[model samples]
Target: MEIVVAADASEKGLGAAIMHRFPNGRDKAITHASRAHTSAEKKYSQIEKEALSLIFAVKKFHRMIHGRKFTLLTDHQPLSIFGCKKGVPVHSANRLQRWAIILFTYDLPMQYRSSTNFGCADALSRLIANRQPPTEDAVIASVDAEVRRLFIDALRSLPLTAEKI
Candidate 1:
């Protein structure tokens, strides 16, 4: 099976995509969104968080396709950092650096995809980041459920062909 992974990072949050090739050879995209550090001074933290989120998405994909060949694509520049020995600029915390090191164990190939090609994941990350917080548990649960449903529905409709990068 062939899979394509995409990720996008903003000051406020991060988003990732796992595009899987089905038995019928059709691509299906699954996505996840998470909040992250937003301050300009702490921009490195934001990038680290985005990288971890991308790693999380890869783990999710691995669960679905164990031992399968896959490619990971990200809009972030300096994709070489994924294979670098020295610390990367965006990795502030040792934990984040360790996470990057651990992800390499999967031996998945990393590809540098342009930002224009990752619009869907970028949009989803923004949408999640913009969500209003509710004071009540019930409201939070409702909102979370709705967001998950919407994400799944959007993934189902994503185009198989790679967007022009």
Candidate 2:
């Protein structure tokens, strides 16, 4: 079986497309989308968008994919090879580490494709719709109470003075 996934994000919204190609040349396609979050509205990085799109595709098709090896295709070069390591690296960004952890379950070898050739996923990605907000709380979830306290302390020390500089 062959699989192709493409994702696109815009200030207006975010979207992803997943495809399963049968050996006979027929194709089954899946499309996923979500509106931008209030928080993510300000922090929607392309790398993050690519990762999220791929994750949605995998989870949506988990029943067909689980415990079996299959092709993984993407337009983003880095995500196709992301977390190639056996485990999430200590130095990885909070979000990336989390995405990697989820992706680790599949035996996927990433392949690169150009943006133009992404097919339906490209068009699907451009569509806007009403959906749940994107949750990207990996950084907050990973922080321990002690770390939070230290961060608070560091912020407090920076400036108690609230005057307009």
| Runs of candidate 2 exceeding 4 Å displacement | 3-10, 24-42, 86-90, 130-165
**lDDT score for residue 12 of model 1:** 59
Angstrom error of the Cα, residue 27, model 1: value is 5.3
lDDT of each: 0.64, 0.65
Clashing pairs in 2: none
Q: Per-residue error at 13 for model 2, in Å?
A: 3.6
The TM-score of candidate 1 is: 0.58
Q: What is the lDDT of residue 139 in candidate 2?
A: 49
Q: Which candidate ranks first by lDDT, i.e. highest?
A: 2
TM for every model, in the order presented, reads: 0.58, 0.61
